[model samples]
Target: MNSTQQWQNVTWFEVDEHQDGQRIDNFLFSRLKGVPKSRIYRLIREGQVRVNKKRIKAETKLAIGDQIRVAPIRYEIKEETDAPVSDKVAQSLLSRIVYEDEGLMVVNKPSGIAVHGGSCVAYGLIEGLRAASGKKYLELIHRIDRDTSGLVMISKKRSTLKLLQDLLREHKIKKTYVAVVKGQVSLDKQLINAPLLRYELANGERRVCVSKDGKESKTQWNVQERFMHGTLVHASPLSGRTHQIRVHGLSIGHPLIGDDKYGHETTYKGPKPRRLCLHAMRLEIPGYAPIEAPMPEDMQSLVAQLRAQKADKVVVSDKDDE
Candidate 1:
């Protein structure tokens, strides 16, 4: 297979067993090196790419023996000036790996770093790992938001990726997140069942809201600790919708602290948070022991401050009674 720049004639590919079940867009990404993702998507949308002699969507899955046609398109060849991953960044990513095996790896991702690169991000965790470890097949099994940090799984083999994704779709894998919300929670445990709709604004910013005409979403929230102003809670999302925990927490009037998107300004003004107070604490997968990431130092410090403030208020109230 020739690279995109070298292609002058139309090309045909037969999907073999290894290539079966992969999305058309992803297949194009792998084969058409140096081709921008936007260009590939445009080609698919313009009917320039076809499968089985018919136009197909980008997400269309390929089957064994499927014939794919790639029409020739010219793109300006640009210099490959992508910077090499620095040693410091590479070591930082290496030290965050909690578990690793031949098939998969569980990384305790840090906040403010994206799981994979796209859009304006030049390189993300997966790209850094690939450069550092020289692993060509490493791919993200799931994604956590850039501002939210915690356990992210990377599959080393395509078979493992397929298996884990199937498990996720069947609701067999369990994911637990810890977050600190704006207000105190009275309930010991609560089930948030709401339908969520995802839409884009005129400025192209994506947002999710609870609406009747939406997909069913559920999150099991349990209070872990209480403060006078904030509540630290464990959130287990039953459905993997975008921003499930954040939207559910907002629906219940306790948006996550430091969540600029869904949270409102609160009257409690003890300590300001630096980032979104959400973390993927634990993940439970069948046939494997639970994988856990300890609370980050920033969150721990915030929780301790809240606890101290609560203690001070208790002492003041007692003094007043006396």
Candidate 2:
């Protein structure tokens, strides 16, 4: 116990066809009795959930015989805490890993899984990573929304974390995203330059809104494809602001198809999508060139289907979000 790295045993799990398309948290709860849904969520955010050595979406459809890697969190706590039932927690948590390394780890978070905890849950992705890695501490370099999925950047060392954070602040890091917008976009590309006002509630929950008196924000958007029914858009923000893409899309009158926070039109009508259609498609870090991750098949298929519908305007651009 002199070193920070400790190892604990975790049981592997199998997913039956009956639970084929269930969200990751739900599956974990059903299989891992006694584990709180919130704790399972924290584990998924921590990069502890893995499937066949790769990070995956919490709600990622499980194929038959999918193997998962799970480890219990062992903390040198200031106070005694209840230990969870062992095998049950392990079974649900081990199925969604895409990749991991000492330098960084990438996780495919589900649409409903928040990257961190807040008013609803006490622990978040950062807390979970510390437990899962059994390290003194692990840090997140960046985060996707609770409902956004795709690659997330994590750092094992504070120095590495600082380097990445600096790069992001200076606009050296580039994040690429794939999304479905509600309307057709005429422009091939456009930019949104808006300001954002961020508010942290009393309970530490945060929300962003557009205010003329807010901080500057910018978003560049391109039309990847336009469908008959809607447009598929690719978005990249010059600045990282909470719900930047979602709010900007709304400001331009074409909200992201499934984002309830920003899609006022769609939300009023009904749930157009089962999950938010935002994906952290790619990221460019400080390196020889850049690292790019492709969009998940589900989103790709969604765009392809929309194209078949012959969308008139398919993408949009908004400057900022709170």
Candidate 3:
């Protein structure tokens, strides 16, 4: 392998402080521009990509001074596959970045943008960020639904990713969400414990339901405000399952407003909301200052409307008492 202008056929990377805590797969994505993420995973699986002379998984975080072996392959930046991001989308992603440091990036991901590309999505938030920043090891530590908007953590260091993932599994990191549901919540506080199972229907659509044979799931919520049409509540899922909060909210008979899957469209009163009225409001990491994402404009408007109605009721009660 020649040490020339072009990359070597098989290159060795010595992880420096900047590279430490970055996942090997993400590192490769940075180095091998134009390569698809799926291909990168395949390389790791086939042992073409290795660390310390042994095959490593894509999620393997590099340590300082670790040596990585990157196998060479025919590479070309295809126009169709490497379609350029529009300036509008690029700027949107750039402006949404809330916090960024050596080890992590927190973004207020917009609703309707998938976290990563797939499911007929040509490119999503992560891809947009990668193109905008040109960083090699940018990776999502957790995911929020495409219809859900809020703080999303992108790990820059492999160590941080591992640590945060561990905390999530143990339910140590606190995540709070605010949502508007279809009916008035009678309980100020309630805990819903149920078992959830996911299934795919004949049409290949996926859904989750509470079943006796499913994994345990729990959601704790308190009514923030009651409305004639619906309820605004603060909800936290104690267990992480796919759609855990959404499913649990549905099980308790207060499906989130704009929940096309588990909620009845006709049940919601007034003008229909433009999007799902759910937002990832805040995140409390064990060692960092709590991060909060302001409610997006659409959801904020709906909540404000509900509040005004509640205040009107109060005024009417006062008049009657007088």
Q: By TM-score, who's the top model here?
A: 1
Query: lDDT value for candidate 2?
Result: 0.64
* Tens digits of lDDT, candidate 3, 219-270: 8887777787878889888887778888888887888888888765436664
What lDDT score belongs to each candidate, Candidate 1 first? 0.82, 0.64, 0.78
Give TM-scores for every candidate, taking all chains together and pairing residue i with residue i.
0.81, 0.64, 0.74
Model 1, runs deviating above 4 Å: 1-79, 266-268, 311-322
**Candidate 3 residue spans exceeding 4 A from truth:** 1-82, 310-322
Residue 218 of model 1: what lDDT? 90
Candidate 1 at residue 185, lDDT?
A: 70
In model 3, the Cα lDDT at residue 111 comes to 91
Cα lDDT of model 2 by residue, 1-322, tens digit = 1223333468588765443333455456434434444556567767788877788755454555677776675432221133222443333223344556666665555566555543343345544555555566355567788888777776665456556667877899888898888766667778888898875555445568789988899999887776655667889999988789988888787788767666655532322466778888777776725555576666666666665553353244443322
Deviation of model 1 at 19, angstroms: 5.0
lDDT of 1 by residue, 1-322 (tens): 1222455579799988666666787677656645665677778888999999999986687788999998997643333445368999999999999999888899999999987654445567888899888887777777888899999998888787778877888899999999999877767788899999976666545689999998999999888888877889999999999899999999988999989899666455657888999999999998889999999999999999888884323221112110
Name the TM-score of candidate 3: 0.74
